[model samples]
Target: MQSFLSKIKDFNNKHRKIAPFIIWIEIILIFLASIMKNICRHYKILLAVVVVLIVIGISARHLASVESKTPEEGSVVAASEEMSVVEEALQEATVEASNEASGEESLINVDSAVSETSMENVDSAVSETSLENADAAASLESTASLYVDSGISEFIKAHTEAVGWIKFEDDLISYPIMQAEDNSKYAIEDADGNDSETGAIFLDYRSSADFSDSNTIIYGHNMRDRSMFGALKNYKEDLGFLDDHKYFQIITPEGSGRYMLFAFMDVPKNSYIYDVCGDNTSRMREFLDTIEYKTYIDTGIEPTVDDKIITLSTCTQKDDLFFVMFAVKVDD
Candidate 1:
């Protein structure tokens, strides 16, 4: 005990700057020791006091750690809500002060720096959210373009003029339709805009791309290899083919359309059926009448001016002759 007291005295004298704190701790230790010695006979009471002091110290440290932690990013909105709660607390405090002081008003001060920082954080969050939304929308559009029908997607990627696709339900004909400033480009060029004898099927330059016109014309070559519109000749050879294979699907970027075969016959290159795509209602009536008069076999389906018609045209062996098939928008 004497040697320990000598060491403590030496430490206090060596570090004079912290000597007062050391002396205070020493005094507290002595006081506790005196109490412990006096209460040594009551062992249960002494143990309970020590445990209580340890618990209080641990709780104080835990509370300080919680209070010292900084808020995370995106927590500004939550912090703003907490600020509202703080304002409510201050209002309550003011009310209590008034009640205690017989209606005397109490001034409450809020830091301007804290309010400005919160506003800036809110603005930053909104800007970041908007940028994220824009990036997501761009990604969705790119993904959708990637997911287009593989054949059509390749055609468009290779040739910008490629417009849509035509498919018969019975698998008679399937081809990509191209459009240009004029109809003759596709008549000699393939879907990839390369020069080929078996040229691509193409839409009329004068008609609306969405097929909203009263009459729309799509032309393809009747190849001997049975590609392109070569299978269309099957309907003419056996009129019975129309009984089951009447519907053809036209798929565009906008949507798809199912058309039922209503007429098929040979027409001149300058036929009036080609002129019905415009806004002239009288011409459309004449066109329908001509179709009824000139169709090869009566399918019992007569289309009116209110309905839309799509015409598939191909060249015959003769120079001036063209085989044509007329289908009305049956699905509409």
Candidate 2:
């Protein structure tokens, strides 16, 4: 303890020539510099302290001689020393006041410097989230495009444990439970099902890969009140909606694919919508043409029988009344 105190004494004597204002300025400047580094969470408090210190320093200084000599000596000698001390103090204070206050003004602290960066971050987060959703949607749309294969059943069962099913007449579309996607099998019945829009007979239908052909169809209600397929109606027009809802992905253990939106329109239900018989080739060709001509907005993708198509059918209540959207598979 004695040694430490002696060291401090010696240090103080060595620094005695330093002006008091200068010493305080250096210490505060060092503190401010540290706060500046982590200012993201404490900028306001540090900035306030720095401002207060500056104001106090400015008002508290007393003009006095560096050393007082005998009054008997020439008075000019005392005046000169005082003038020198004042100049030295002022110069030292200025240096300590601005220590570490330089460099980049910080991107978040200044709107002019960092607004674009923040916007970019928001855009990136939204874009990433959108990408995740798009990937899920793309997977869904891809499934719609496929002709279900046997291997796909295992894939579906393994990945999509959470499944929701709906029956509108003879059609059903199964999906995961949560807002995004899941692999579990859940229940979704039609308004006319066991519970009249609820499900007393929620059944888990295995993938048609075992018995159904590559092409399968599912239909649901497009209630005017916007329950099942109501959200799909917006695709019938051009809007930023496409920006949010483009492409679909249908994933199964067998395969996963990216799908592009190709058709949007109302069609007659009894138009023999599900006839994939001997006339399938010509029928498919005709179907493709009709959908191409009917798309609300062209997504720039052409359809071929080589490409499996997934048709999302819903009720429209119009003359033809089948609200349908077609999507074709792209990547697996």
Candidate 3:
């Protein structure tokens, strides 16, 4: 009996980090059962206690049966020292796991804050008509290659009238920006940059876009390595994100145009603020108004009425949905 007690004590001392967590879990289970039974008179706390005890018994039996314990014949002091090393390793692992969890939680919190701020800005900026017009904008399917490059910038295929791709930074880029809205081909890349590696989905769901304006909504995963649009999420907290990536060079097959960042706001999932009127003037005016209202910080390049626009959208760990940053086409 004394030997058994010493063995149990040694096990506890060896796995101190795991021991406390298991004990706390047991306590929590027991406490929750107790509270539920007390709140419901028909549910007996005694029965809950019995159930918990049965669970504990089964767990102990399983552990005893599954774990192999080879008794080491060594000096008692040496055994104790080995046990201490094991305990230290377990504790260090536990601490590292805890720190990782804390960091994830912080990222989630930051995402939530950014989402909330985005919605607030959108709500403050959008007109009631803007919300309603999003549906109307969806009614029209934009015809391709109508844009005649006014000699500002153009990427035409060799000896062909139709232009759907371009060469940028010495890389041949193409467009019609191949995207699979919601199906098997779930991948996107800059046809212009020829980097299918971008792994971004450029979306155009004008059930939110209210205007004749092309809503080139793009999306990318926020990878930890800053791969895809991982670096874009950095815009949530600082200028390091903003300064490094502000302008987007959109190289469609017919033309390559740049867009300057005009607005950075996170709209809610169902926010119909993307709609603009059929009347071109009204549509442009609406864009001007919303951009002016939601422009938290600028990307420095001023967007005028003539430039087409691009919208980059992504989900954050903090929110259950997404946030978007808006920019307009530029000639350079």
Candidate 4:
């Protein structure tokens, strides 16, 4: 008996991450077993039916979570391929910036040369300049090209509703974000346009699709299988989780936004926190004050009206309860 107990302890220690799930399953089984032994024999069949239904529910939830782990059936390219494309886009931007800088230098040199030339030779010096150089100077208006993430581009090709991608560094919160005419569509539909209870992470319809608004709000299901925004609860459960995991990235065609978690809290479904995309500075200040007041933990970082805010919202266990995670664009 001592050796058997030691083995069980060792197993629990080795699988500490899933120990809670294992313990819950064990508790349910033990309770069911005890009831089976004590309940009248006439009710045994009914209990068996209930057990089967519970198992089916658990299985279905697990299956749905696993299915959303990857992008819809070939909708997204492989990681390596996506990385190469990003690298290429970055290289192109760098080269363009360098070339534009060079063009400006050339124009400066030409102007100086013309200035030094005698008045009689001024027209000839300007005329001698190549048409290509003139065009390059005019084209210097834009030094950088807009880079869209290859993954986002591919997903958009498959489904036009795909607007951007959201990822939490060193976490399981990476997914393509979807948008529709209304927020209700993606709430019940997957990125691939299939119906799913664990719907795709999506931006609020009222907010700008490019994330140009003063405040952008995103929504995802607080799934039981830890998919979508399910893990966001950790911020409220353990404030220490924010020490290392406070930063997340919002990748868009305009640019990639690096945001730092500032606050998280549970609020009513119709909380003023949902009043996003406002341009009023005084109202924004009031919004910031309200956020500071309602947040569960103090991260010591306060966002100003000038800084763009992003909110990740999910439903809690209660119908009227909602959990929200707020972040500021630290990269800007």
lDDT of 3 by residue, 83-118 (tens): 864653453344335435553211112333311122
lDDT values, one for every candidate: 0.69, 0.45, 0.46, 0.68
Among these predictions, the greatest TM-score belongs to 4
How well does each candidate superpose onto the true structure, as a TM-score? 0.53, 0.38, 0.40, 0.54
Clashing pairs in 4: none
Q: For model 2, how does the per-residue alpha-carbon lDDT over 1-332 read when each residue is reduced to its tens digit?
A: 99999999999899887869798999999999887788868879888999999987766553233234336556878787668646534533333333224421112223232211111221111111123333443454345334243344543454443223222211223342211121111123321221122111111132242112233343443422233354565665444556556576554443455555666766665655555422244577777777788767676777776667656655442334566677666665
Candidate 2 residue spans exceeding 4 A from truth: 1-194, 198-215, 237-240, 277-282
Best by lDDT: 1
Order of all candidates by TM-score, from best down to worst? 4, 1, 3, 2
By lDDT, rank the candidates, best first. 1, 4, 3, 2
Better of 1 and 2 by lDDT: 1
Candidate 2 local distance difference test against the native: 0.45
Residue-pair clashes per candidate: 0, 26, 19, 0
Superposed by TM-score, candidate 2 places the C-alpha of residue 141 at a distance from the truth, in angstroms, of 17
In candidate 2, how many Å is residue 199 off?
7.1
The residue pairs found clashing in candidate 1 are none
lDDT, residue 311, candidate 3? 58
